[model samples]
Target: MTLIDPRNRYPRPPFKTQPQDFPGLSANMGPEPDYGLDSYQSGERLKGLVALITGGDSGIGRAVAIAYAKEGADIALAYLDAEEKDAQNIASSIEAIGRRCLLLPGDIRKKTVCVDWIDETVKKLGGIDILVNNAAFQHPRKDLLDIEDEEWRCHFDTNIHGMFYLTKAALPHLKPGASIINTSSVNTRTPMSILIPYSMTKAAIANFTVSLAGSLVEKGIRVNSVLPGPIWTPFIATGMPAEQHESFGSQAPMGRPGQPAELAGAYVYLADPNNTYTTGALLPVHGGMPQL
Candidate 1:
């Protein structure tokens, strides 16, 4: 599960710069941003593929869905009913790319709903080729004791339990060369101070992705995870406490947060057939977090 190899190494950037000087100057005279949004363009990597993305309504999920559509995949978006406006915007964007987009509103926390989602997607889209389990909910807590039983259960149901349900439901429809990409967070690698329960769910995703990759590889399904560091998304703005939200991803070596567009390439790479040999991997999209 560990991809970091100490024996093989790469150059480390100087760490003594001020926060304002972050993102750093490139080898050329120009300065580079923390994450390269301009460089994260897509080819027709997923042409003819059909992808289902939970949380496809907004944030990184929205970016991935749009990127996949631009790459030539028809999309099925599953999101909570509360995200109607955002979901509609994503669907419109997808359609603008000349790809078909189906928006399904439901609570993924229920097993029945998960099953229904896959069944409906297959019926609407013909078959499922890529499954992206990316919906999650996290509430910041001052202490573990401050977390209510309902909140803990909600985290488990939305983050881990729903992922299990949807993956199981979609398995029969997914064929060889299909990919299942889960969204685990950097919290799994470096646990956050105030996100105890949420961090636990993310860690579970990392373990589950590895376990599922092993179990499904014989069937030729590729399973992997993307552990994002601190991306600036509506999830942070709305999901976390208003006060703590300001400092969301500032502590990373990159100093500033990432944009949604920066994450699109990683998803495109993993979903593409070119990455056939890679599976059971946790690709860190964190801003140069030191690997242990």
Candidate 2:
């Protein structure tokens, strides 16, 4: 067995300044975010289950989708039409692993899109055993007044509202022993001044996760959130200023950013039926970043 030091496992500071437009594609990212295409090994932990993951085209969502598929779960990926290339690539990877993959491309900000995707996943992939509310929007503004009204609404609409819509839509189809995982951020606790809107939504997501967990426990549904710190993904490439890209994950004590591959195991553990007692938990996958 080989032991790897977590601190230096992934790329560190001085990242290339390759910024893209909003909703950036991982394909264009320098040192492209790793979505477990090669490193993750399957344990067949979630065999024969079905999962619906928003933003499954790239970054953290892509990692989770691939990990779930490797664990023997059929996947339904929901992403934007603009991210079709990334989505298609992930779908192919999942299919290559001998798992079924369904692609639903649309904006999650619309309630109709959220509901339709759930229905389609049920109709096509059997049923939803895991619902991952991972799609989100973020834009940094140094001044609160500089955050436009539309931008503020966009943050909440894409983050919390979409999660609410998707969860409500997926609940009925999710039977006992189902898992609902939301992608929250460490900013919920250590809010970034410039990321006011995005950080606020993350805080709300954490609360929603805990509250939903209590409400669903009696039904045998597990609800939880994964709070990630500064992970190297397209979020940084597009959301922050080009100058900030160089030191992206340098703030973390680990001195490096986490790759999506690093967080895949956490989702797998939460979705495993054998881990029945672990619910309403906020699993922190930050690299030595203290959440509280």
Model 2: per-residue lDDT, tens digit, 170-225? Answer: 98898999999999999989999999999999999999999999999999999989
Tens digits of per-residue lDDT, candidate 1, 37-113, equal 22335678899989999998777888889889888899999998877877887788789778999998999899999
Residue pairs that clash (backbone atoms under 3 angstroms), model 1: none
Q: Any runs in candidate 1 off by more than 4 Å, and if so which? A: 1-40
Q: All predictions: root-mean-square deviation over Cα?
A: 8.2, 0.9
Error of 2 at 231 (Å): 0.7
Over 4 Å off, model 2: none
TM-score between model 2 and native: 0.98
The candidate scoring highest on lDDT is 2
Q: Whose TM-score is greatest here?
A: 2
Per-residue lDDT value at 47 in model 1:
94
